[model samples]
Structure formats: structure tokens, C-alpha cells
Target: MNKILRSFTLFTALSAASVGVHAGNYWTASAQDGWIDGYVEATLLLSGNLDASGIDTDVDDGTVTLRGKVETDIDKALAQELALGVDGVIGVENMLTVFSPGDNDDAAKQRKLTDEKVATVVKTRLMVAPNVTSADIDVNSTKGVVVLQGKVKNDAEKQRATEIATKASDVEKVVNKLSVSE
Candidate 1:
């Protein structure tokens, strides 16, 4: 009976230790995943062809997986490359699908190009403006409509951003979604 009791106690202790180890590993993995998600997001945002809001990223043990829809295969490939380039990323599994093919019409292509140009110009204007940190602002353009989404220092900063976006060539509308700092 004593031997049996010793054996059962050993088993219980070992099992508890195993559970603790597993919990520790789980927390470590969770933190790593959060960091990887943020890194992937920043990478996607830095890519000119990719819209970060449209992509979802998951990370497990230094392996980054991308799951989302992009406008073209090139954008998918670019996302994979960007994720792979992250410092701690050991591999990238790209499962992104192209949701829309390129418009075959010349007019549509021109319009898309123009919208991109206008957004870029507006972003540049904000970058050069006094007291405006362009990095805090997100600019997106579609069909000649420029959308500004971000937080600014004050009401003046928000109005300045709107003015800069409005002055961009070919911008038909400015949707200012900027909020003042609290």
C-alpha cells in the first residue's frame, strides 16, 4: 500500500508539472502571435499594392500564414514576400485568393491609376505640411473619392488634413473621418 501511494503521488506531481509547462508555453505562444500579427500588418500597410485592412494574418511558432482576398495575384505574392521578410518569421504560408481580376477596360484602368496617384499626392502633401504627422493618417482613394481615416492633434489638424486631401488633383470628394485627440 505504501508503494502504491508513493507511485500515485509521483504521478500527480508529474501531471501538475506538465500542465504548468503547457500553460507557460501557451502564454509564450500567445505573445509571439500578437507580435507577429502586428509585424505582418505593418508590412502589408507598407506595401503600395496591398490594403492592410483586407488581410488577416496568423502566426504559430514563427510561421506566418496569410488568409484574405486581394485584388490580384501580384498582391498575394507581395504579401507573402513581405511576411517572409519579417525578422522573426521563419516561413510564410500564403493562402490569399484574388477576389477580383484586373479591369480589362482602358478607362477603368486609367481611373484606378488616377485615384492611386491622387491618394499618393495627398499623403505627400500631408507629410510636408507643418505640424502634421502623415504616419498617423491613413489615406485611401477609390473612384476619385479620397478617404482620410485617423486621429489628429486637434480640430485644426483635422481641417488641415481635409484641405490637403481636397487640394489633390482629381479628387472629387473628401471624406474626413479624422477625430481630434482626447
Candidate 2:
């Protein structure tokens, strides 16, 4: 039983999905190889692809959790497969809105000078841009780095979004999470 418990704990720790970036105490995501965050960020950006079907993904360490809704079961299956294909993703969870309730008012906001209003203003700036689409993306203001995700038509669109995101006054760095369609 002790061995089983240990294994299960390891699985739980290693297999975290994007839904909850960490099991508890979400304080700046202080985990090693923080590169996992980058991989997760990249996956979310790519998911915006027209081929990606717009499944909002979350990740902690290497554990990726997905949310939002897709059009079909095939879409869900494809989403899971895509995430698994990524090099650093350790796990994938699709808690997406196969049939979702309206957007949840509850969200975590940490270490940001910009409030939701400012963030929205920034997002609106990007959304209005003809080239870059912000759907199926997660925008969090943690420590001044504006992380972007979603699918793009090509590298040009991805690069465009990164430039737009950096336009914000306090945005220190823009992490590109856009993915390309193969």
C-alpha cells in the first residue's frame, strides 16, 4: 500500500493538467526546469490554429490540462493527440467545455500592474488587428510577462501577435505561444 501511494503521488505530481497549474498554493509557479512553462505556453498558442480547434490548455511543470470546448469528438481526440506530440508535455487532460457553462468569473490574478480593464484594452488592441486572432488563448499577467497562445496561420501571424502584445506599457516580455498549422 505504501508503494502504491508513493506511485500515485508521483503520478499526481507529474501528471498535473493545465486546469490547475499546481496542486495547491499557486505562488509564482516556483518549480525547477521552469522551461516546462514555456512548452505549455507554446502548446496553448498553437492550439489557436484553425486545425487546432481552439481548446484552451493549461500546464504546470510538464503536466498539461485542457479546458474550453471543441466542435466534435474528433476535435477532442485530435487535441489530446497534438498535446501528446509536444516534446515536454508529460500529461494532457481535456476538461474542456464539450458542453460548457458560461465563462467563469473566478480567475487568478497575480503580480500585475494592469487590472482586467487594462488587460482587456490590450487584448482588444490585438483582437482588432486583421492578421492575429486571439481565440483559444489564455492571457495571464504574472510578473509583467504577457504570455500569449493560440493557433496562427503562419509564422508571420505568430510574430505579429508577439509585437502587438509588447505594445502594452508595463509588458516586460512577450512569450509567444502561437503554433503553426502543419
Best by the lDDT measure: 1
Look at candidate 1 and give me any clashing residue pairs.
none
What lDDT score is found at residue 52 in candidate 1?
61
Best of the candidates, TM-score: 1
User: What range of 10 consecutive residues in model 2 has the weakest lDDT sum?
Assistant: 109-118
Q: How well does each candidate superpose onto the true structure, as a TM-score?
A: 0.52, 0.37
Residue 85 C-alpha lDDT in model 1: 52
Clashes of 1: 0
Give one digit per residue, the lDDT tens place, for model 2 in 1-182: 99999999988877776436655435545352255544444443444321344556566766778777765544455456555545456788777554432232333322221333224434655655677767755565455677776677788877887887777655688888768766
lDDT of each residue in 58-168, candidate 1, tens digit only: 998999888878887556655776676555788988888888766445676566656655665577568667978677899998998999998898998999899888876
RMSD of 2: 18.3
